[model samples]
Target: MHATLTAPSARRTRDRATLVCGIAGLASCMIVIMADFTTATIYERLGLFADTISAMAAGRGAMIMDTALLILVGGIVAIAFGLWRQRLPGWRWRAVIIALLAVAGIIAAIALFNEYGDGDVNDSWTFHYRLVYALGIIFTAVPLLAAHDLKPIDRRLWLGSYALGAAWFVAGPLMFTVPTGWDGLLERVAAGIMLLWLIGASIFLIRQPDGR
Candidate 1:
């Protein structure tokens, strides 16, 4: 009886940890959806610079604004989780990185929208894209690698997903460069791909454990 009770107690603790992570992940996913919606609209305004999201501004801005609010609220919730739960150092860093990258991605998307297909890439725009992509990639992957705080299966998922992510970012300089025409679809596409990838990884990181 004592052994059975101990097992249940331990299981409950793990379940709680997993639950918090899942809640956080779900919150973060909502933020990404908001950001992506805005991006699609802005890209539309930019003339389908991406596969979708071509020529949407007011709508996109509204979405981005909503996303920002969601992110802020999510952060508050996350902070409460961290404070109340025994989060691992790895999990803490993961949360921090996720926050930073999401913010940077939003800023980059907005900057691109403002550029509005000037037909000329400015130094600042160029710099922001490079920095945003690189940092986003690194942050998204590193935390996955360090995510030992999670269960063994979660750690494995992090390893596989992040490895591909890391490889993608490392090749950014070569794969993503300035476009030569009125439509730099490739560059925009790459950026979109990175955002979605990070979003997916973040979701995985945030998910609550099952059967814990």
Candidate 2:
């Protein structure tokens, strides 16, 4: 009877791992989305409050740069752990890094048009908000999309989150005709969805066996 119980427990453990991996993958995407939106909020400050904050940020641009780098690393780690735990060896660190560099480059290029680039101090720094957002989006989307062993629940959560990626992509060029604030609204929607997905995944996984 004890041996029979142990056999069932071990199988249950394996099943739990699948759930955890799925949760990790979902969390990774959500984290990237949240971080990206955060950087965008800081970037889109055309109001007095934004100007004040940007002024302060510009004064210590290097600090902001360092902070962005730290987040970049943290994002990478989260993504790697999610992939490893979930048995996705292919879309691991290499994917995260390549996506990061590409997205960062795009945002940095866009930052040149902003007011911050007026001085040498700003030029010395490399924390382009757009680049970060792009990186966040790509990294989050790629991992979940490519996660090989996704359970049905994982697919349900991620498929919904993937729509935001499309929404942001479509909204990007549309900003030229509409208002800049329009992008902010879309980002807020994306942020909310990402948060909800992460929370939901957490609740689903918390009760499952940790060994799984």
Count clashes in each candidate, considering only residues at least 3 apart in sequence or on different chains. 15, 3
Q: Stretches of candidate 1 above 4 Å error? A: 1-17, 38-46, 50-137, 140-144, 147-159, 174-208
RMSD of each: 6.9, 7.6
lDDT of all predictions, in order shown? 0.49, 0.46
Error of 1 at 114 (Å): 9.2
TM-score of each: 0.48, 0.44
lDDT of 2 by residue, 27-73 (tens): 55555454444544565334322232233234434345334434434
Tens digits of per-residue lDDT, candidate 1, 115-208, equal 4343545664565455556555554543344344343556565565555456555544544444544234554454454444444444453453
How far out, in Å, is residue 30 in model 2? 11
Q: Could you tell me the C-alpha RMSD of candidate 2 in Å?
A: 7.6
| TM-score, cand. 1 | 0.48
Q: Residue 62 of candidate 1: its Cα lDDT?
A: 46
Give the number of the best model, judged by TM-score.
1
